[model samples]
Target: MNPPEPAHTPQPDVVAAMRGDLADWRQWLARVIVLAYAAAAGLSVVAFSKLCDLAQQGFASVLAFNPWTPLVWTSACTAGVVWLTRRFAPAAAGSGIPQVMATLDPAVPAEARRAFVSLRLSVMKAVLTAGSLLGGLASGREGPSVQIAAGVMQHARRWLPPHPGISEHGLLVAGGAAGIAAAFNAPLAGVMFAIEELASRLEQRSSGLIIAAIVLSGLMGVSFFGNATYFGTIEVPTLRYSMWWPALLLVLATGGLGGVFARLLHASITGQGDRLGRWRAAHPVAFAAACGLAAGAIGIASHGASFGSGYGYTRGLLQGHVDVPLLYVTLRVVATWLAVWSGVPGGIFAPCLAIGAGVGHDVAVLCGAQADASALIALGMAAFLAAVTQAPMTSFIIVMEMVGGHAMVLSLMAAALGASLVSRWIARPLYAALAQAIIARGRLAPAVAAPSR
Candidate 1:
């Protein structure tokens, strides 16, 4: 039988070549899966933005018909949303940043992380955030977007190639950064946020994955929202050293306020030492209604300027197209605090920017820079965000991209750094503190219920 063609044995070289080809194919497949995930994340964020817009429009129509409608409508909406969230997805409450942070912690249990980032919680987050906006709550979608996108990424972990290198922590970072990039159409800011706020090292193997995800999602945002700057470009003059004083003033004022806001927010959300926190914990739904009533009153007093995420108001202030009262900043801050403390799902990002913009305007007037308030406003935005997040690099980069204020890059960096330092003196890192609290709560939850059983 001609020795059966040497028993059809393949050479060592041939076998090795075949194995190499298979490895290459697997790598490419993994890449494709990551790309697909990035695209899905972008699409989800765009859809969420559209829902928020529609909700805001409906609320605007209601306000047009009767400015006082939010009094009852907001209270009812808050009560319903609070009840639904507590019943079905208690993890979906607040801005969602802490939940995302908690998931990245290695010490947190897999089960707790899974519970925090379930698809069900993500869906509820999107719907209830829209509900909050529809009721004219001072909430933003940006923070919730991070958690939503992370949830999508976490869910996709089951489909990934079973490789030790592809850790859940890396996926969470990529997903959350992609959310920020897609939400604001700022890709670089997304990368910086991953490094600074999310505490991602961008390990060699996963670095390419993180960047690719950001690019794809950001491109999707550009495709839908166009390549224009988020807040539109301004005609800022060349920065002179003499004009730096206003930035310093804003650093102190905005930073101080931002620190206070972070402290109060953390206390309220965690129910630490504040009396209001105890009340909210005891009767969440009823307390939400009361908070809503207060928000409604603030909105009425501010002539609707304090409603929604305050995006339009901030843009108006930046463009000098709208005029608000001296107490606009105060009202916006209080409104944001109440809306968040009510136990609804929303973000403080846009509301904080609006508050910062108002502060910028006041500073500009004081410093006699009324002729060009855009730069000061941009500085205030960066400063307050940095102070609140304790992430100066990410804050400045995001502000720069949002306003297209490259000319003021140095000033933005300075303001952000200065404000972050000042805020550090007043409060702990807001998201990290909240994240640790989440982990502690998760650890205690079973024990707390075990006694009941």
Candidate 2:
């Protein structure tokens, strides 16, 4: 009682502990670790981008040698790449966004999650995706970039302390956001993608980490690629009230087609009660070779415009510098679907956008809105993406950032939302459905193996 009256002096150790709590070395270290991995992931993506460019250039050289080179070359190379994917990294196949989504899901077993985002799987994904492009497959790098970045950030979980504020889910989301930011050089779009596509909801604790990752990774991307939009800006005419009908028509058209494409892709990938899918599952390599040959034939018919990611073709169309055949959309869609159906490591983003551009160009010509074709092309790009992914916010934001089409923001929004709504009636949300399939497969594996044991 007397000691209490005299007021107990604070113990030095206790005071030091309080001070240490304020310092929070572990918390700081966790932040540092997250940031370091994010930068590394961004740089890795930049390197991958370079690899893909080289691959595309290499394929262009090959295609120039002979218009039919892809028939033999693409077939053989696709067979080899698919074999490698199946033999070494089955998880590396496809756009990989589904795998990332599955990893973030709690229902996916911990073992399956690790396998999905493992560094080894990521390396295979990059190499095989580059190989796919080198073989003249119609694929994009953006979706694979998301998975690669997530895998890189997944490694941080090992180094980080068990802190509530820093979760594996947050890291994966941050990594994916960083990937998009770095890939497109669009930080705001990355954030929107994180919230809209990657994470269902952005928690308060993870928001800072997500932003930091995007900033760090975005800086790295800017360092390597400069601060330019992915598609570069276009001189869009000031939109008028008369333009509304054309925009609506473009949205409906692209959204409907995009939905069909998504449905077909999902059915093929899941191998669900389809004869062609069953054949694909049974003879993956042979199926891939056939897809390559078919896609190659289509590319020859399109004068090689349907091969690779269709980036140059899409950009040229956007700039009104190139005129594709009326059948370009049909050729591109079939070729892209074939490539994706092959189960090789590739993405549909660029190819999908290319298809949309073709659709828009055709719609404008048919509707006698040629003057606003550029704007419609841009709208079609956004609309198709939104329709396919069912993520209108992410789609419009990404397209807006890629093209610097701020003047057409409202139009872009209307197109994106309208297309997404239209798509819903045609197909389920693509990535989410794919992710669920992945989770189902993962759960079945253990149970199926238990019977064997």
Candidate 3:
């Protein structure tokens, strides 16, 4: 007792070593978290896809007998679902990319956190998106996949170590990126999307976390879905000198059409608080039913081509098995517009690619270069998506991955850059502008939220 206790001390060398070890451990933990997110998101999206596919089959079954019956049934169901979503889980409404983009902003990360990234909202999104598919809406599930993954990872924060360096924004971006990687099995595209579409500033995201997350999520996808290009493979050889003419024509055609589509969609959603917009906001359920009716009418006219996500039609076009009519592209575009304007929980990625394929087919016929249909279709997909998102890099990379090769990189690049330039004439960017509006709404009305997930 009389002996003075030696003062506790740490050797500088030993302390430095400890700090280094701690940093490494933190990084290791971050990787583990990302992997966990990847596995969960991949498995969940796969299951969701299966269920939605089954629902689409049911819609097809209904359509086989009488289109009118299905039309009325779908409209009623659409109205009911939209009502429920608005009254209860408002967050599960439209393509969720905008919500994720809004919340990831460094300036207002906390504004939409509780509303958009909650576990409860994720569950609602899953259920509602499936319901929308069952209603015969022209919708895709990928957008909901992004929201679910982000929400899951954000909620899993409780399990992470209580380190001072832990960052919520980093986790959100990683989760969203992982979701896209798993959804399309495109890892690099996922990272670019996070940077190009989600975060407004580099400091808001953790690049290390995004890479780790994408690898894990993409691996899970490769394991479950196999390593096939999402749109199936294309055997593109060296382009003939004559192929350039059709390719160039396709670039302008797709770019102009996509730009107009993007501008129209933007105007419909954010119509400067005009009469139509105000009426839509005031009577959302009625308007959603009407939109569903219009989509159903388009599907009837297209002989069922306008139903579901249009994935099967597009894939068939790629494999040279489906001979789609020229009018199908215009009808499908109308269907997509109706469904999107309805604010249903779905994505436009699959539909846009399908429409692009249709456009390519027509352009090929007009240019008498139908022999290279697949290449033209691929180019159109890249071009239209680039114009829509104003993300040429992400669009080109995703298209390349979807096609499973680099043979068309140069061509895809040409289409993407050209389309992006044309799109600038219409608007700044679709996703970025929507994201800004969402952030403003989140702060003004915390209870109001609308997205796919």
For residues 278-384, write the lDDT of model 3, one tens digit per residue. Answer: 87899999998988888887877777888888888888887778988549888988888888888778878778878888888788778877788888888888888
**CA shift of 106, model 2, Å:** 1.2
Least accurate 10 contiguous residues by lDDT in model 2: 444-453
lDDT value, candidate 1, whole model: 0.86
Q: How displaced is residue 409 in candidate 1, in Å?
A: 1.1
Ranked candidates (TM-score, high to low): 2, 1, 3
Q: Tens digits of per-residue lDDT for model 1 on 270-309?
A: 8875677778788999999999999999999999999999
Which 10-residue span in candidate 1 carries the lowest summed lDDT?
444-453
Q: Which pairs of residues collide in model 2?
A: none
lDDT, candidates in the order shown: 0.86, 0.86, 0.78
Write model 2 residue lDDT over 301-352, tens digit each, in one string.
8898889998898899888999896599999999888988999999888888
Evaluated at residue 385, the lDDT of candidate 1 is 88
RMSD of each: 7.8, 6.0, 7.3
